[model samples]
Target chain A: MRLGAALRSELSKLFRQRGTYAGFVVVLALVGLLTWGSHYHQDRFKVANELGPDFVVAGKSITALFIARAAMDVAMVILMPVLVAIVVGGLVAGERQSGTLRTLLTRPVRRSTVLLSKLVAGCIYAVAVTLFLGLSSLALGYLVFGWGDLVLFRGGLAILGPQAGLLRLAEGYGLAAAAMCAVGVLALMLSVLFDNPLTAAGLTIAVLLVSGMIEFMPYFEQIRPYLFTTNLPMYRACLKASVDTASISISALYLLGYVSAMVLVALWVFSRRDVTC
Target chain B: MSASSVIETEGLTKHFGHIRAVDGLDLSVHAGAIFVHAGAIFGFLGPNGAGKSTTIRMLTGLLRPTGGEARVLGRPIRDRLRVGRSIGALVDEPAFYPYLTARQNLRLLASLSGGARAEEIQEALKLVGLDQDADRKLHTFSHGMRQRLGIAQALVPRPRLLILDEPASGLDPEGLAEVRDLLRRLSEEGMTIFLSSHLLGEVEQLCTDVGVISHGKLIAQGAVGGLLAGGGPAVRLRVDDARKALSVLADLPNVMAAATGDGSIEVGGERDSAQLNELLVRAGVRVYELRPAHRTLESFYLETMRAGKSNDRPDAEKAENDNDGSG
Candidate 1:
């Protein structure tokens, strides 16, 4: 019951802040831009150029699924992770800097309970923002461009029917949301360690950027598979004509392990830490 | 720990690196009665950096003590959540989300403490005279308003004990009186309040009991009236031939004498005014008038701090006045 009340309180605070809506608005605007840009310049599309003039990429072929997939590629790789970091970074450090953590800790609620509630709330926000981006891009794309069979260039060229395409899109979104949740939890851990929200959020982004660099660089090839960033784009596995369940499962387990480890470290530090602020 | 005490500490200490913010010190506050004060309003007094806030933080479970132990409401301080159930604390300064309204802030805080009814929040607002501004955002609140809201939050959960730090720091005289009245009413209803403040006058008026700490050690603790009475009697006198009188009174043992601004002599330490008069007269100094002097809590506090310092170091400076002894 205490945990429930704390969760409710946490969620209420998260939603009431104007910054929370700013993330969604930004996501929607980006999706809208991407869809409009794709509509006006279909011939310039990379998929069209790769497939040559034999397969026209204009009109009925530029579907909602394509827009969502394009948006996810950009959003999950960069935009969503940064947004998630900013939101989760403020969870503990912002309160500490503002001197509100002292107020919150003095209450009858357990420190572990408070940390758990915040983690759950951050995860909820991650899922909500991820789904909003996916659905909003799909809707805006459909409004501008008509639906059609989904074409794929990932792995090998294999066309999918509308039903199978939508299923793949949903699966991709779910995996991306799970990855973003891992980022949020990682930010939460940084928030516990730092007193300044900006420092925590900036450090989380730096970690993301450096990890992304390591994942793509040839110098880090030996350790590429071990990096969490290497697995962050595992959602692309769902987009393939023949999904690699084994690889996706490994990535999912790695993310789950990362989140669990972050949660435990956060809870331990928060419980024993002094609230001098 | 006594059964009637609501707070008890044995050698409670907190060391921040090399600085001992709170040294090994023992403290106690009774539940409702049988303490120094008739009511259970424990006023923790100390000079700046004297560890009053550190002690209050430990009692409220905001800081961990380096050594020793403390218990609030019969539970050890380590059981913070349990101890928090019966105590409402406002540590350091009152802080809330600037975008949140007064009512919303209260509701958020209330939900953390097992929840509070809307009526309870309203009543707390009314008590703090913020009922009309309950819907207003906290960003618009002044410091005095924030202090009042801090007190109101402590009352929202209707806890058995209220621990406040500097509860009257920024209040005007009018606000001070209103808060004084509110605290008096709360005490009348049997709430044990432990507060730390630099407002000696307000503490004198509102608190039944006070503990004075200096250099991280508690030097004095007792009823307001009893502690003040312990200063002993001081006598003011008007004497003819002030030079001779000073010379004559110097011969008297254990008597401290100083001249007042109005050309009269004030003497303390020795209770009897008549003996001094006779001794001065026989020594060729005429004694004109003699009367007892009044000592205030401020004077007592300064004198105790002086004495505490002197005792802490043998080479310390002498007291400003001869009568200024640690009571």
Candidate 2:
């Protein structure tokens, strides 16, 4: 019961802050930009030239599902991860910098309970931002471009009906949300080590950029599969007409492992460190 | 720990690497009526870096002591689940969600400590004289208002004990008096208040018991009246010819006299006030007023600190002597 109160308090604090809604605003702008950009280039729109020179551009192909999927793909590159980083990075470090952590820690709440509530709140924010991007893109695309079948050219050509494609887009969004949550947890752990929210967020994004860069390094190929960035893009596998359940499950497990390890690290440091701030 | 002691610490030590912020110190604060009409207001007095805040932090479970253990209200300091609920604290500065209103901040803090009813929150706000301004955002508050809100938050939980660090830091004279009266009222209601502050006069008037700390060590701890009365008998005389009076008192055997800033001569050491008055009068110095001087907490604090510093010098000399002999 005490933990429940603390969680409610934590969530209230998180949602009440002005910076918490920044990610949603960024998502709205990105979705709007992507929707308009896709429409402007609809005449020349093609998944890939490698799919075929004969596969001509069709305006009807720019459907709501396709646009939503496109928005996720574009956002996952840097936007969504940074947004999650900013949200979760401030969960603990921001309070510490502002000297509010000392007041909260001195209460009846346990350190572990505080960390857990923040972790859950960060993940909740991650999911919220991701879903907001996905839904906004879909809703705006339907109003502007209309709905139709989705033609995907990832790993070869695959045409999916609107219902099947919407389901696939939903699955992709869910998986993307999970990946962003893993990123949030990673930022949460860094937040425990840093007293500045900007420092933690910047470090998380730097780590993400470095990890993304490492995937292309020939010398790092052996360790590439184990890197978190490799697993973050695993949502793409769900976007395929023939979803690889086993591969998705393995990637989900890796994300879970990373989240659990990060949370444990956060809890250990927060519980043992002195709250002089 | 005594049966009536509300706070007890055994060798409570906290070392920040090379600096010992709080050394091995034992202290006990009893809860019964010792100085006040009821309850007990224990003031932990110290200089800037005297470990007063460090000790209070440990008791509040904000910082973990390196080498000692403490219990508050019968529960170990580490058992925050029980102890935290029973203690209300405002450590260092009053910090809250700047975007949150004062009432909101109190309510949020209240939820953390087993929750508080609406009336309890209102009563706490009213007690701190913040009832009308409780709806204002903390960002708009001045330092004094923030300090009052800090006290209000501590009282919202209605704990058995209050641990405040410099509670009157940013208050004006009126606010200070209000806080003093409020604390006295709380103590009379049988609440144990353990506050750390350097306001000696306030401590002298408000606290029933005081513990003096210096360089992370407890130099003195006892009743305020006892500590003040324990000093040597002294007398203060307002005389027309201050220099002549100083010269006259200097010839006396045991009297140590000096002209105070307020144009009065303070004579320390064992001496009768009437004898000194007559001696000054005989020396052609018109004595305006003469009375037995009462030692202020400020003097007691300074004397205690000086003695503590002098005591450290010998220990350092002995350690140096032992080192030289070994070499």
Candidate 3:
């Protein structure tokens, strides 16, 4: 019951801040711009290849499903994590900086309960952002380019019919949201460690960027599997002609592990901390 | 712990690395009639850096004591959630979300503590005289307004015990008067208030029980009246001839010191007023009035602090004073 009250309070505060809506606006604008750019470039390519079926690109249909899948790729990789980092990173550290955490903690609530409420709130926000990104991109893509079979360039090219493609898109969004939730929890852990929200968010994004760089380096290939960022792009597995259940399960498990470890550490530190400062 | 005590601590100590912020302090505050009057205001007094705030923090469970135990409302201090439910506190300065309005901020806190109704929030605002500006964002509030809003937030839960740390720190004279009146009203309504302040005059006027701490130790804690009757009971004798009366009182064994005041003799010692009057009459000095003179809490506090700074234990000094009176 106390957790529910804390969650409601947290969500109310989150919504009142302009930054929350600003994040949503940024996501929509970026996805819209990406959709327009893809449409314009696809038109140019079609005009350029109008006379030559011999030189045409094979198995690359520009459908609504394809556009949404492409948008999710960018959203999951960059936009989603950054947005979640800003929101979740500010959950604890920002309150501390402003001296509201002292007031909040003085209420008739346990420290662990407050931390859990924030984690739940962050996860809800992550899912909301993911759904918004998916639905908006899908609707905008349909308006611009009609829906059809999805042709994805994975494992030497794979294709899915329109109905199956929609289901895969939903599954892809779910996986991407799970990845974002892991990022949110990691950022929240950093938030509990630091007194400044900006530092927490900056460090979380820095870690992600550095980890992404390391994941692609041939010299660091051996360590790639251990990095949490390695599993973020696994949403692509949902777009395969034959979904890789084992690979998806592995990615989900990796995210869950990261979330559990970070949350446990966060709870431990926050519970033992002296809020007098 | 006594059954009537609302707060009790034994050797409560808090050390911050090398600095001992609060050291081996024992304190007890009784439930109703805190010292002299029912639901009276208890003031925790100390000079700056004297651990008054630190002690308040520990009692409120904001800081953990390193060496001892404390209980509030008959529960251990470590039971924060249970203890917190019965108490409302304003630690240091009031802090709220700058983007949220006063009402919204109170509502948010209320919700976290098991959901205070909207009417309760409004009532709290009215009590603090912030009802007219309840909708204004806190960033736009003056410091005094915010202080009042802080008090309002504390009141929203209708807590049985209210602990305030320098509640009058940022208030002007009018705001100070309003807070004093509000606190008195709350006390009349049967709410226990424990506040800490360096404002001696405010404490003297508003508090019934006071604890004075110096160098991280409680130098004195008692009824405000008892503490103010410093050294021992004395009487101011308004006599026809002040010098003559002083000369006569100087010869008496019970009179500790006697000096002429404004057309009166200010006598200090354990001599009874009746005996002093009889002596003045037998000595042919006409006594107009013989009234007990009480020392101000300010003078007592200053004396205690001075004695503490001179490497003299306050309790020993107080014991010496008590012995002087008995002898």
- Against the true structure, whose TM-score is highest? 2
Candidate 1, residue A274: lDDT: 83
- The C-alpha local distance difference test score for the whole of candidate 2 amounts to 0.84
Candidate 1 residue lDDT tens string, B305-325: 756775763211222121134
Q: Is the docking of candidate 2 incorrect, acceptable, medium or high quality?
A: medium
DockQ score of each predicted structure, in the order shown: 0.64, 0.68, 0.52
lDDT of 3 at B200: 82
Across B68-118, the per-residue lDDT of candidate 3 in tens digits comes to 878787788999889898889998889998889999999999887787889
List runs of model 3 lying over 4 Å from the truth: A43-60, A216-221, B29-38, B232-294, B312-327
lDDT per residue (tens digit) for residues B14-83 in model 2: 8765567777878753422222222789988987777888898898888899997687876789898788
Candidate 2 residue pairs that clash: none
Answer with 2 or 3, whichever has the higher DockQ: 2
What's the C-alpha lDDT at position B115 in model 1? 84
My TM-score estimates for the predictions, one after another, are 0.88, 0.90, 0.83
Which digits, one per residue and each the tens of the lDDT, describe model 1 over residues A99-122? 988988889888899999999999
Alpha-carbon error at A202 in model 3, in Å? 1.5
Model 2 scores a TM of 0.90
Q: What does the lDDT read for residue B108 in candidate 3?
A: 93
Q: Which candidate achieves the best DockQ against the true structure?
A: 2
RMSD values for the candidates in order, in angstroms, are: 6.0, 5.1, 8.3
Ten contiguous residues with the weakest lDDT in model 1 chain B: B314-323
